[model samples]
Target: MKLKSLFVVAFVVLAPATAAKAFPIVRIDAGQLIGRTLDGVDSFKGVPYAGSAAGPMRWRPPQAVRPWRLPRDAGEVGAMCVQPYSPGDPGVGPLPMSEDCLNLNVWTPSERTEPLPVMVWIHGGGYNNGSGTARLYDGANLSRRGVVLVTLNYRLGRLGFFDHPALAAERPEGEPAGNYGLMDMIAALEWVRDNIAAFGGDPEQVTIFGESAGGVAVTQLMVSPRARGLFSKAIVESGMGRQRGVTLAEAEGETLRSTRARGVAWAQDAGVAQTAAALRAAPAAKLLTPAPSIYGGDLVINDGIIVGHDVVTAFEAGEQAPVPLVIGTNSAEFWWIKPGDDTPYGRFDDDMTPEQIDALAQGFGGREGYDAHVISDVIFNEPARHLARMHAKAGLPTFLYRFDVVSEGSTEPHEGATHASERPYVFDNLYSVRWDYERDQRVAKLMAGYWTEFAKFGDPNGEGRLRWPDLRGEVDQLLEFTSDGPVIRAVPNPERLDLVERLYQKAVREGAVAPPAGEVGTPPQRP
Candidate 1:
């Protein structure tokens, strides 16, 4: 396949700023010398993409990473932004807390003269937390399969996302930074475009992929004109558009009002004014924590740089990148968000009254109301389906799937495919987890093959793999990844999804969707 080269020259403009070395060791810009440790095949790590987000730059867009006068240590992993996690997942020990956490790692199968395919992975954490350093996200197995794998860390929580009008005013004319995390991803891609060739990766064959919010970010990039030509394909594992719309006015209003309220309350407690300078000078932790709850500072319409519009709006208007896409969700996505033992799909004893059943159903949507089922629908299924539908309607090649396999010895509480469950299988990183290998081993091999196939040829078709279907029609089939083997089946639960589709259409007509539907409209389909 011919690699797209629209922006290859742009990288050349940035190349003079890069080092003149080859694999295992290469220059990123003028200053840094990234180290490498490949298992025979070429793989590199700890390549700085942007300067640190520490101190003053905390909660701001990533700055250019300054090169060290001496060779920087790229061997040890970087600090992961602070986040909450379950007992099984421990925290990164003793890494310094700073806002300057923009960096990327790469892995390749060989150091040969040929430039291999590249896959840049963005980790998922509900717009709040997660790090590229996580064990399950290791790219070793993926690199071994002939693709140069990359994983990166962006600003998270208050440090990566906080925004203020004061900061907006600080912009140089047309540039404003609010979605620092997204900005960090953009900067990383810019670095990749200029530097990947030195790492044995074809800059023209880059595919950006992610899960959950990272997935949402990938789709957002699709709609971002600024991101055009940077990547040739996209893989959004779960984050669809369930919670990704905010106009700059809307976002700014929300931030200003919320920050004022929280700041006033804090001022009353600490006896100080709620002015911008006051807030800025306040103890960083004290000021930052309350800002997110009030203003939702992570992402907002910044007007110029980001176009400060809704993702769905840009996509429907055909402003998004026209790239081959692989998008999908898990079958039992609700299993991951169950609080306590309250699974979304758990059986309810038949002792309930009609009213109770109605209420339960209403909570999910009447039959599928805002209740427990919304957990999966919002985060996984709906978003994935929306991307497929939008791309297919726009005449772009789109592949979809539902991962339905269950690991062997997996208990009922976690019986079906849950969110992020497929990561281990796709990356073939089972060694990082303590799960039973009986069922996982087979599924892992199959899935790893499918993912690598897609990354290699922009299509997940290969010998011994099921013929994956395209997302062209309403009843389009999606590859079902399971232990038995991959099977192309009708998009899962067409009837249920149709019902939800009607709900969205109704909401749109009623103007209930805050981010108004752009030019994109779903033609009425006969049920």
Candidate 2:
């Protein structure tokens, strides 16, 4: 986003105080807010929905936002969640990162009594990094569409999801505190429920939407009983019910084993092993390095708070909220993984061998593994299909789609639609953006229309426009979003998806893959 000048313009001064003071202004907050332009869209940015999770609160559940002494500054952006990233990742640049990054942003058409539909956004960063401050996430365009838009930042990485047995034992009577990150989201929803009316939004008409790991978080909220009635609808893009977390016993055991193997050696070298407090006090930077697979801290099973788990099973059993859902993925979801032949971001090795390919295929679960690397299947296509099936099985209204739009990169069939390639088209912010500015307008209009329409009503199938079919019956009809135009089709390949589902079923049936801690294997506990 273009950085606005730091000097406070006179127009920014909030009303009701004095001429000497300067504060970001919102047009209305007293009466009914009807359809209005950007001039009347009251915006609040960098609002603290939760307390700063720093110092002793780091790696624990979020605390309540304390009362401010002055009119809190909501014009600026908030701190970003901590995560390790170099400049190599596309659309990602080096910026300040921190643990005290639990904040949110809000946009409303007006603070009138119209009670506009609310859409809350959760960002995707593999459960490690992200903020509500990303430029493309700016809610100005959507707010102009007669809806209230909200974007939030949740705790991530070790600060958000580290689980320990000792920590569980320390919980106060009725308060369970594992899955602190998920709780942060629930807390944010609670805050919105109490305060969104001031921004002209109906707390009852809220829709939760997200991408990637954020999508995964949405799935968790859908299945979580504690999260019941928080959101009335959901949108999951490029992420779905794949892996459920493990149990508290499992998570604590894994932490103990992992720390003892890696952290213990460091602790011993530092001459402290009698207590875990010493390890907790170590510099967060030293502990933030990305470790290989299991030992690296990411979302795992936390038995304490995330009870009655396994999101996939929960959905299948009709345990999730029976709300309308739209889920889909990009065609070239994994294409970006291969940046260039010389690039370190792509490929498992400098040279590709049949043996390595065979190993990879086998590791992905035989035939399903072979299908996973096919751009769309892993990131978008398969997950979208899975969500549809689960929702359909439960007899709920579900819409599935495929984003086939491609740029002029001119690779091969594999380069048609990459992961997150559809974002510009979805938000209509492509004009003022960095990538694909000139080419992303129309698609943006169509997607933003679909999303906003879905928010207004429960359906994207509006009359007098492009017809989007609901997910009904056995046939999987997908709304194809491409540069040519939007059309509905019987997706392209079913056999690949069939193979993938068979593999998933095989893995589930035989217990070949363990659910992430605090999940399918463990029973639910009362909070």
lDDT per residue for candidate 2 within 391-485, as digits (tens), equals 97788888888888875533445546766666666667774345453345667778899998988897887765588878766359889888877
For each candidate in turn, give its C-alpha RMSD to the true structure in angstroms.
9.1, 7.2
Q: After superposition, how far is residue 497 of candidate 2 from its true place, in Å?
A: 0.8
Candidate 2: stretches off by over 4 Å: 1-40, 86-95, 111-113, 254-276, 291-298, 302-304, 336-380, 408-414, 432-439, 514-527
Positional deviation of residue 430's Cα in model 2 after best superposition, in angstroms:
0.6
357 Cα displacement, candidate 2 (Å): 8.2
Put down candidate 1 lDDT per residue, 457-516, tens digits, no spaces: 888889977788877653467888877877878776565565556556655677554212
Worst 10 residues of 2 by lDDT: 518-527
